[model samples]
Target chain A: MRALFAFIAGGLFGSGLFISGMTDTAKVQGWLDVFGAWDPTLAFVMGGAMIPMAIAWIIRARRDTPVLGGTFPPPAPREIDRKLIIGSVLFGAGWGLAGLCPGPSLASLSYGGIGHWVFFVAMLGGMLVAPRLSIRLDRTVPAE
Target chain B: MVMDWVWGLVGGLLIGLGGAVYLLANGRIMGASGIIGGLVDGTGRRDAVERVAFLAGVFLLPVLLYPLYTSIDTHITGNWGVLIAAGLLVGIGTRIANGCTSGHGVCGMSRLAPRGFIATVAYILAGGLGVVLFRHVLGVI
Candidate 1:
């Protein structure tokens, strides 16, 4: 049952990405191109996303248990440390350069865009490699 | 313009609803980065059914929608090396930060998690600087 809901939800998310045309890497890359004719599409997309998110958040906050079952687990707490800074910096650089983050990249793979395949492979590899590095370094940070 | 807004809203709702549903049902937050991260550490089976379904949806959505909207265009200029390097960096970032923009920006923020707040602010600042670095400083644009 939970899996089914998640599937439906994921489908909704992917459809949204597809409908917003975010699967098109050029459009995403355009947002990063601030000087050579700026594309405000990404901003608009962000704006569009915030609306429903805000509403859903409000609803979730007011309730103790969700309509489905358990109580909200709430995210774990942590301080902003060196790992946070470096990781975020890396994320920003990658996003600005590639114009596709993990979620959208995964979403876009359906388009069969070669770029997505490259992005997905690299993303999976990163997911694998980052953990081994963490284990090797004896770091205990949760993979965000 | 209308289509764009509609799609964006739908996508947001889906994520929010999915997240809410996931949290309500399993007492777990719907964070892709974390789930993906956990999948690496052998916790994959803990939520095996849901995780695989969520991931599959991520890949299947666009394929279903392509026929309805024909204006899609995906192009890239940079070489594969750069893209791979970027992915590596992002992987490291998510691990260190303990959340991605989605986890912090949506799930965390929704729960008013302080860490999420700080992480998100940092994310925005870094994102801004990265754009400047790539477009202006490096002249990639």
Candidate 2:
């Protein structure tokens, strides 16, 4: 049941990504190109996706357990720490550089050509090394 | 017929509905980075099946309906330096930050989580800056 949920949800997410123009590298970069020939469509995509998700949170509050039998995550800690800030900055920089994030990076794999594969492999390597790098980060800026 | 912000909204709705389903039914946040990152990093080795299954679905859907999306154009950078650097940054950043566009921008912000808002703002700001630096200044890509 959980697997079923994941598969269906994944399909929907992928379909939306393609349909919404999230998969278009030039379009994504255009959205970020505020200083140049900027595109404002991504705002709609971002804003629109939030509506259903916001409602889901409302539903989540009244419900106890999930339909497929799992515990909902506890509320995220209300801390604004170094890890999050630094990490997000880095992610944004990379996103701007590539015009692709985790979801679309994978979604475009089959047909996004060699460049997509290169990004994927590099991203995978990064994911593997993140924990070690994170440990080092913790050493420098111990969490509060 | 012109692809404009309307399609963006529709696609956004679908993405949100996807998040809604995963959140309500699976009892998970449906953050793409977290789902895949956990498995690769060993923190989520126990739930390998869940992660792999989800990925399979994410990857397969586009191809299964290839006929419909044949004109898919990603326009990804062919510059190896940019691709590697960008990919590494995204992988490391999203994992350490504990979310990405899907988790933080969509799921996290939707719930009004402070981290979500902060992360979203940070990434957007950095992404714009990245454009300035990588494209405008360096002319690397």
Candidate 3:
């Protein structure tokens, strides 16, 4: 049941990317153009996402237990440490350069979008390597 | 921009609503990263059927929607090699960050998670800088 819920959610998220013009790298790149050809579409897309999310969260918050039978999973760690900063930078860079972030990239792949596949494969590789690198570094270097 | 916004609103609402319903029915955050991660990390059945269907919706929906609106025309000017390199880097970033834009940006930020907040900010900044540095400054744009 939890898996079913997750599946539905994932689909909606991907659908959002498809409609938002986010799947188009050119559109994304246009937003980055500040001086000459700036596009504020991304901002609006974000707003569109935020408004509905706010409403849904309010309803969910009132619930004691989610349908799957447990309390809401606690948020991941909240620290704004070095790892957070570096990881974000890398993610953003990839998004900018490839014009594909995780959400849209995967969604795009469903259509056999060439770019999406490229991004998806690499993203998976990165996910696998991150923990290994962190553990290795943890053992090799003293904690600050 | 207006067109994109309309699409975004419709898309977001549908996704959010669908996600909420799923949450209400089950009890999971509809985060793509977590689902995919589970699929890849040995929890195959957890995401195999549902996630696959969800992904199919993502790709096919555009084709369905295009008829009702302006068609999306994508022209890639970058070399495949460069795009692939960037993708690999992004993959790593998503893992280190513990979620992707969908997980952190859409779902995480909605819950007001501090980590999601920071991660989203980083995502925007990095993406913005990447465009300027590579596309604009470097003439790729």
**Candidate whose DockQ is highest:** 2
Clashing pairs in 1: A87-B93, A144-B98, A144-B99
Candidates sorted by DockQ, best first: 2, 3, 1
Model 2 CA deviation exceeding 4 Å by range: A142-144
- Give candidates' CA RMSD values in order: 3.7, 1.4, 2.8
Winning candidate number (lDDT)? 2
Cα lDDT, all candidates: 0.67, 0.89, 0.68
Off by over 4 Å in 1: A61-71, A75-78, A135-144, B1-10, B137-141
TM-score of each: 0.83, 0.96, 0.85
**TM-score head-to-head 1 vs 3, winner:** 3
Backbone clash pairs for candidate 2 read none
Cα lDDT of model 1 by residue, A1-144, tens digit: 777777876776666666666666566666666555565566555555555556666666677776667566643675556666666667777776777766777787766556667766877777777766656544655576
Output the lDDT of residue A28, model 1. Answer: 63
DockQ of 1: 0.51
i-RMSD values for every candidate model? 2.7, 0.9, 2.6
Superior by TM-score: candidate 2 or candidate 3: 2
- lDDT per residue as tens, model 2, A1-144: 778778889998988887788888887889998888888879999998999999999999999988788699899778988899999999999999999999999888988899999998999899999999888888997455
